[model samples]
Target: MVSSSPQTLILSRILTQNEAQPEAEAVLVEAGRVVAVGRREDMQAQFPKADTLDHRDLILTPGLCDAHIHLVAYGFSLTQLQLYGARSVAEIAARVGQRAANTPIGTWIQGGGFLMSELGLNDYPTAEMLDSVSLHHPVLLYSRDLHLAWANSLALRLAGVNENTPDPLSGRIVRPLGTLLENAAELVARAVPAPSGAQTLAAARAGANDLAARGYVSAHTMAYEGPEAPRALQTLAAQGELPLRIWACLPHQRLPEAAELLKTNSELFEFGGLKFFADGALGSRTAWLHPPGFADGSGTGIALDSPELIAALGREALELGLVPVTHAIGDRANTEVLNVYDGLRALARQKGLRLRVEHAQHLRPGDIPRFAGLTVSAQPIHLQGDAAMIGALLPQHQRTSYAFKSFKAAGALLAFGSDAPVARPDVRASFAAAVTRVADNGVRLAPNEALSVEETLWAFTRGPALAAGWTDEGMIQAGARAAFTLWDQVGHQARALVF
Candidate 1:
């Protein structure tokens, strides 16, 4: 067991990332912060009676940090019905039936993790198939990307969604089984009652604990859920229940309210990022792209929020000391975001905010360097699952998809994370994907884009720390956080240890 006592400990082969090679060292922890790191002999002579734990064969490095993730939602989804491996619509229906039989009548049956392509249904599944089993309970199952949702007849009727219902702005209504895309899904989601404060807090705690178990010492939770999520995290922090440090963002729609919240409380948890969506994802064929969009002629793709809106809000956010983070998945989306970022570069520099782009997956070669001085918060693990989609829908993007090496060369700050509730936040898997560049199809997306193990570690640690504007964490050195992650080796095993 590790001691909490403000004592000195000598470790073997401490990796200072600042140094080229590992060093035989000692670390002094006091008040949960690293006080000193020096030669083992010097530390022993300086504090002979201080408690010491030697990690002879273990590598001592900074704790891992996830740059982007959804906290409470991911946790709640963990216990929900899983449809990740369902091969066909029949399989999905069977699972829904099983869940419905046990559930009380008239309640909404919610579960996720289905890919529309894998369902064997070219057309969306209507509520008829679900109504065939049990019309008593409403069902709303989300696609893997969460950009699209499939609802049963009961759920649609309850939500007042019909063939005559108009699609919400920046959203789509798939004909037949009432599939709502993007903001349209929120309509039905809004009708559902919000979770209680207790439930929200519990889910947040569960999510944090789960991430900690997976070797994460901290995270930058992208605010996609309502205000309740960050409030829940603050509650945990106040009670000393939070095991990891949290840096949270707020959606642009809630900017005014968030500004008021920040005016009163800025240090409760690091609150300094504004989240925006530049476009939808590829799964739903909503990602904005260049000419010759989607090999299947999905019609040039869908654009969500305009770059002008992001830039306008970004300027305001900077005035309040908040960084701007936008989601950009397609080549067009990335291009537009880069244009907006270019407009804010000077302002970002003035405010000391590193403008960030989430999921800058697909990119044009010429626009790559425009990301310099910006934080590229990306998911490498997404490549493993997205390989097929890239081949089918985005053949032009395959060369630059998830281009970690290219981004590094362009001087972009690379931060890696798993968009949990979208992809499992497995640190080992993320590292493997970044370092190996191998995909699910057993083919490499771009061998030139592979990152080194150390580079991957830095992205998971220091890169995210810098992106989130955190100075006291993400490093193993004096004045750094006492949090640390132990790994047997890259892609092997890991666990988080918070002092």
Candidate 2:
């Protein structure tokens, strides 16, 4: 019931990404593959007995694909406390207090999506703020960027993260025992109870259904989750319950394990890349930068994986026939990853693989051209929230922050995603952010960087397909996969209309 894979005729105004044949009035599908696309009259004449559905008023395009997401985590977040638009710390505390009031004592209350700046905080938030409301129950709230975590005193105590605890490499246990940055967050997260197998499966289902409802037929799930997360997706695929195609990555630390498992490319589930982090995020004040770091005088941010380590692991990943997908958000991070990539380019090309950089959020003008021929998995929706932050913390890098136009002009495949849980995976917001270059505060950040509507659409569709090496997807053409999204208008309401 998730897919109408039988022979069918879909009549609509189709916008195929194919430059050779851009527009069509109908599409014919058989066994989940597009058999023909042409004027409605011709399709009807050719397949007179095929079942037909009239959608002449709808605009049909290739199914939307979120190029980056923590699918299971996003699903779990749907039920968690939403702190996305909280205007003040007091508001977040109130929500935590309310959740604690209904739950049993000693249970952990988990939620995220708050920005320190949005909360009007000049310094790092402390456990005391959350303690004022939920002292008996442990509470952990993540920043909007997902790179930092704020924990109540009880949560800190349970995690044994005291002032004496030393910072882990590339991670920080912020002073006064409240905030954890980068890998240090794991110190507290590891103490939290893990979701059961059934819970994981439910979360997976919720994520897939949510994306499907939002017109996404495929997702590239970034590796920030447990092994069980992918297993749940695999289970769903096995049961024919999965509604979206999944392309997953293994954390760099799991390289040995991934090699042992030897996951290969599949239409429904693919383990195609090895993921790495060159640095943290901007909102967390942890995005690695060069001299004159944060405009606020916070020193150059933390560097996660060294270039040497990335190269070594990247080479191994290539041998295993997987792409090297690194998370690089700062200029220094991007530069370092690019240098490492420079060495791997030959091997990658020899292997017929496209290297990818996740975020590529902030870049040096000189480094912009280096992204040519690479996959820049960016999240335009992030610009809505990041505009103010970029202006405030990285004014020197403003011109290149979320520079979609530059990436496209440089010939980099620009794959757009929502980085959900960091930002909502809403296609409409992506279009608005890319086309308007407007922020939540109604301020436009680098308006000159705005991309055309057609360009943005390709980033959300065709670009992601190329990044995933999915030739049959991201286009509505003969012999392509019969996955489509029906939209009232390009940037308006839309829903998945897959066969």
Best by lDDT: 2
Winning model by TM-score? 2
Off by over 4 Å in 2: 1-6
Note the residue pairs that clash in candidate 2.
none
lDDT score for candidate 2 against the true structure: 0.91
Residue lDDT tens for model 1, 222-279: 9988888999998888888888888888999888876677864434376878999988
For each candidate, give its TM-score against the true structure. 0.96, 0.98
Compared with the true structure, all predictions reach lDDT values of 0.83, 0.91
Lowest summed lDDT window (length 10), candidate 1 = 15-24
**lDDT at residue 309 of model 1 (Cα atoms):** 94
Q: Output the TM-score of candidate 1.
A: 0.96
C-alpha RMSD in Å of predicted model 2 compared with the true structure? 1.2
